[model samples]
Every structure is written in structure tokens, then in C-alpha cells.
Target: MAADPGPTHPPQHPVLVVGGPTASGKSGLALALADRADGVVINADSMQVYADLRVITARPSPADEAAAPHALYGIVPASMRMSAARWRQRALAEIDAAHAAGRLPIVVGGTGLYLRSLMQGLSDIPDIPADVRQAAMDLQAAIGSPALHARLASIDPVTAARLHPTDSQRLIRAWEVMQATGRPISAWQADPPRDVPAHLSFTTLVVEPPRAVLYARCDRRFLAMLEQGAEQEVAALLGQKLDPALPAMKALGVPEIAALIEGRMDRATATATAQQLTRNYAKRQMTWFRNQMPAALRLDAMELASGTAFTKFYDRIMADMTKNITKMG
Candidate 1:
């Protein structure tokens, strides 16, 4: 009989990042891994950070959260926007706290920017003046995102070319930066990044299932959320009458459900529309993770969801973490 080997352990604690498209079972994987590794699950999803729309956002349920330590989920109000830099600050503190308690830090979510900020750091872009910010928003609302992109091309062609014409948020940001400072936003981005600490090493896993399977999961999950009081969640959020541009207000399913409540859309139409949007968002997430995270260990979503496969995967991850650790001493 072969001799049994002891549990694999790294010389130093390593942060595990579980990134994937929505409805990809990242939360379940993270929860199970947290329990096995004595880790803390930290939220990296931008939508999941908002306190409102918990049901609509498909945040981990209370029962699941009770099974292990979780942090940075549903902490920020929907009325406020969270920048990548701000989230990095909060997430780093959480990681430090988790390390101090002798637990692994598992950062889980599909937010590429958030994960990137943690691993690669962020550029030092100066804050845009309030008036300048408002002007950019007003212009975007007045002319629509595509038209605004054209206007941006006239001034900052380099930055404008990189952003999708329909990417209203980023388009507005680039325009705002150009207007606030004489230099383009790309110039600011080229400056050396700050605030990244050198002590931590990371093992990242990205779940990318077959597209057909992922789309079906996305559709099913949105419908499940509706049955689980997502409509009520959206209605309550709309009752606050927050700015439409707010990230939470624009979260998936919010607009469709809000239209349903307002009588502008029928129930079936709203459900179908939201499901399609969710699938589209999932596709974008898959593309971003596949193209950006070259070094991540890719797993099939179905495997991550399976009990036997997940156990084997966890062992592989432990080996990877131990092998990939960067010496700090």
C-alpha cells in the first residue's frame, strides 16, 4: 500500500481568488473551501456589496453565511458608489484581519476590476470636481452613451477607442477626467500605481463552463430570484427614488422589474428581458476573465458544483497555493 501524505501546507498564508461569471457557483465553492481551509470569504462583487437588492443580486443566503466567516458583503448602501480603489482598501483590511485570525482569505466574485486592483494595483487618478462629474453625467443622459462616445473620440480618441460605445459608465469617466484635467485619462493610467503591498501571494481560479450551460444557468437563476422576492426587493429600492445612474439602481434585473412595477412592462416581458440581460452579462464576464487572467487555473462551472469534483479540486488548489507562494522573508 502507498504511504499516506500529510495535508499540504504553504510556508506563508496565500489568498485564494475565486472569480467567474454570475450563477457559476463561486459562492458555494468559496463557502466549502472556507470551511475546509478555515478561511474567510470576502466579497469582490460590486453588486453584492450594496446593502439593498440582496435578493435580486443573488448574494449568499443567511444560512450559508452562518456556516463560515464572510466579510464585505452587503455593507455599502446602494445610494453610494464604490470605486475599485476604495474596495481595494476595504478588502486589504479584511485580508489582514483574516490573516491575523489565522484563516485563509478567499476573495470571491466576478468583478474583474476589483480582483485586478488587489493583484496589480490601481492608477492614481485625481478625483474629478463635483461640477465636472455632474456635467459628464448630464451630457451622457442628454445625448446617450453612443453619442457621448463620439464626442469623446473628438477629444480623447485613444481612451475613447478602448471603451465600448455602449459602456456609459466608463465613457463618462474618461470624459470627466479629460475635462477635469488637460491630460487624457489614459495618461493618468500610465502613471505608476501606488498602494499595492508586497507581502501577499495569490492563487486564482476562474470557472468557465460551456457557454450553453452557463447561459441556461444564468436564465434559471434570474427566474429563481424572481420567485425569491426579487421583485419586492426592486420595488423597495425604487421606492427610495435614488438616482438612476447609481450602480445599485442599474444592477441586473432592477430596470426590468422596475418597469414591471410601473406598468410599462408586463410580467412575462420583464422576466424574459431580465433573463436575456443576465446571460449577456455572464458572457461578458467570461470573456473578461478568460482574456485578462492568463495565469488563473480554469475550472468548469459544473465541476465546481459537484461534490466529488470539488473535493479533488480543493486538493489541487492546496498544492497550487503551496507551490506558488512568493518568499517574503
Candidate 2:
């Protein structure tokens, strides 16, 4: 008999991460990879987690969902807020389930915070009292985020300096922590011994396309969304009368579309406004990915547009994974 050969690749599967700005085709890449690897597509986008405003949020269509196993998309109610800590917990569990099933876990999204929390672990901040939380929200609504940011700067200059003045959600959160715990959120973050998982290895693929291409895609996608009943989706979501501060209410197209529904803006104005916002958001996402994931493998968005490039990309990933496992052994 001929000499026996070793198994083709390593037995353990590394967790795969597909990350990029919105409309960069990361989702399509993820779907293709998942189909090939028998992997599960886990939601990492914060906006896509909401059960409401799916169309405006540009969540996976019914056909896309049916094409592969997906986890953690559209699971949270719009009325409640989801923290990165909560999302990390759920994501870790989903990853474990995928591994146990002998499938790759593809953590896919552009939410840098959620991905960071998953990799580095969250700060040890205690829960704020409901009254304290409500008070912070109320104060921001009354005085606006810039004003609240000024207040936070006095209490926690380090954290304040890091946040944008107009970022209402984080500004309110910082104030709530200070009021509830009498400690700066930044101080808690400096505490040692975080809860990072040691067992799993992660391989991240970041999609970076030319700015012109990405911006064009963002604009085109939003228009397609409008034609596909985004207006109705926004109307239904607004009908719920959820708090304006809720994350879902602030998703890329929701507020703009809500304005249209309420006669605050005409349809054309609303569409144009939403497209601009999406482009701005995509730019921010690109910046975040570039700054944060320095070690990730980068794929040009145009590269994934063709079938040949996708096959080549897949082979490159497999080759990299094999090299990593070989080094480990």
C-alpha cells in the first residue's frame, strides 16, 4: 500500500469575522463563505439587531436569511436598548454553538463596539438605576447632547474628551454612570482582569473599497430600500411611539423617513437626506475599521464583486488558516 497521508487541514476551526462598512458587500461575502464552510452568519451590526425597521436598517432579506443559517438578527425589541456587554454574551454563546455543530462561526457586521467588546471584554460598570437612567435621558432631551456633553466634561474629562459632543446616546450613558455609581465610566474601564475568552482564535477579514464606490453603493442601496417599502416600515415603527432616544429610532434612515411620514420633510428631501446620512455613516465605519483592526486581512470591495475573486479570496483564507494552525502545532 502507498504511504498514508496526514489529514488535509487542522481539526479545529477558527472563528471567522467579516467586517466592513455598510454596503461594502460584506454581507454577500459572508453569505458566500457561510454556504461554502457550513458556517453560521451571526449579526454584529447594532442596528440590525432590532426587530423593527428592518427595511430601513437594510437587514438581510427573507431570501437571504433562507439561504443560510443566521443568528442574532432582529432579535431585540425596538423599545429596549441593547448594550455591547449583552450582545457579547449572546454572540459568544452563538459562537460556541456553531463550533459544537462543527461549523464555522462568522461574526459579521460593521459595529466596531460590539466586535471590540467581544474581543477585549467589556468594562466592569454596574447597572445604573432606572431612575438615574431616565433622568439622564430626560436631561439630554431637555438640554440637548452638546449641553450634556459639557456637563460630562466637568465630571469625567477623560471619557468626555473621547466622545463626540453630539453623540447623545453615549453622553447620556456617561452621565447616568456618574450619577448612579459616583464613579467615572472611564475609571471602571481601567480596572484589570477583563473577561476575554482564551479558547478561540479569530481570523478577521475587512472589506475596504474605494471611497467613491462605497459612497455610491450606499446611496443606491438606500434608494432601493425606499422602493421596497422602507416608507411603510418607518411608518409602522413610528406608529409604535417608542422613545426617541432608543437606538432603533436613530438608525440610519429611520429618523429621516419618520420626518417624511410626519410632514416634516417632503419625500424627495427625506430620501436625499437619508442618502447623505448613510454615506456619512459609511465613511465613519470605514475609518473605524481601518483604525481598529490593523491586523485583519483586507479585501477590496471590487475584488468580491466577481466570482473568480471570491474563489480566490476563499482559497487565500483557507491557506492563511492552515498556516496559522501549522504554526500553532
TM-score winner among the candidates? 1
Model 1 clash tally, residue pairs? 0
For model 2, residues 1-329, the per-residue Cα lDDT tens digits are 98889655445447888899999988888988999888999999998999886888788888999999999999998998999989999999999999999888999999998998887788888888899999999999999999999999999999999777877888999999999999998898788637876566678889888999999999999999989999899888888888999988888888888999899999899989989988887887888888899899988757776888878889988887677655644
Candidate 2 segments exceeding 4 Å error: 1-13, 325-329
Model 2 misses residue 117 by how many Å? 0.9
Summarize candidate 1's per-residue lDDT along 1-329 as a digit string, tens digits.
Answer: 88888565434558999999999888888998999999999999999999997899899999989999999999989999998888999999999999999999999999998998898888888888999999999999899999999999998888887776876778988999999998888888788878766667888999788889988998999889988999889988998989887888889899899999999999999999999988888888888898889789987756656678878888999988888774332
Off by over 4 Å in 1: 1-12, 304-307, 326-329
Mind sharing the TM-score for model 2? 0.91
With candidate 2 superimposed using the best TM-score fit, by how many Å does residue 274's alpha carbon deviate from the native? 1.7
Candidates in order, TM-scores: namely 0.92, 0.91
Q: CA lDDT of each candidate?
A: 0.88, 0.87
The alpha-carbon deviation from the true structure for residue 48 of candidate 2, after best TM-score superposition, in angstroms, is 0.7
